[model samples]
Target: MTTATIAKPWYREFWPWFLMAGPFLAMVGCFITIYFAFTQFSNQPIQEEGLVKRGLVIEQQGAGAARQAAVQSKP
Candidate 1:
């Protein structure tokens, strides 16, 4: 006995659409992220002197953290 197979078009299949859903959602997410990055995030110009100022602030913070650590270690 021989069997007969029925052929169907690609669009009528479920797997193609199922596989495409992930990439479609990813592309949509990327577009939304880009929109927010341009509109919501800040565009700042940092001056050369600002680098020194930032470094000084970070150094002071590190010194404070070190003092805290030293005090904690005394116990």
Candidate 2:
């Protein structure tokens, strides 16, 4: 005697769709991230007041050091 068994089509199976879900969701998330990145931020430069203050402080320190060196050199 001989026996035969019938198999279901690939689309009706469970594991193939399960395996595909990861990359599909990842692609969706990637597009969402790209959309938000372009829409949520501005193209203008940031304000520079903090940097200007820092530069002024550095210049004052250099001048103070030079004045101290001049006083020490005069015996």
Candidate 3:
């Protein structure tokens, strides 16, 4: 005796939705990240002069440390 087997539709299946949820959530997160990137950070202005001053301060501190190291090595 042979029996008939019934198959469920693709949308009614659990595995397809479970597998698709990963990429679907990833795409949603990607869109949110892009929106924040353009809206939150793109409006900020760069401070070139402040960056230059910070670089000069760091260089001077490095030179001061080098001078101290040289003085200690001389003895």
Identify the leading candidate in terms of TM-score: 3
Which runs in model 1 stand beyond 4 Å of their true positions? 1-3, 44-75
lDDT of 3 by residue, 1-75 (tens): 999899989999999999999999999999999999999977655445333233235222455677899999996
Error of 2 at 29 (Å): 0.5
- The lDDT values for all models are 0.73, 0.71, 0.75
Worst 10-residue stretch by lDDT in candidate 3?
51-60
TM-score of 3: 0.57
Off-target runs (Cα >4 Å) in candidate 2 are 42-75
- Please, what is the TM-score per model? 0.51, 0.53, 0.57
Clashing pairs in 2: none
Q: Which stretch of 10 consecutive residues in model 2 shows the poorest summed lDDT?
A: 51-60
- Between candidates 2 and 3, name the one with more favorable TM-score: 3
| Cα RMSD, each candidate | 9.0, 10.1, 8.5
Candidate 3 deviant stretches above 4 angstroms: 45-75
**In candidate 2, residue 69 scores what lDDT?**
100
What's the lDDT for candidate 1? 0.73
lDDT by residue (tens digit), candidate 1, 1-71: 99999889999999999999999999999999999988875364333522423423522245567789999
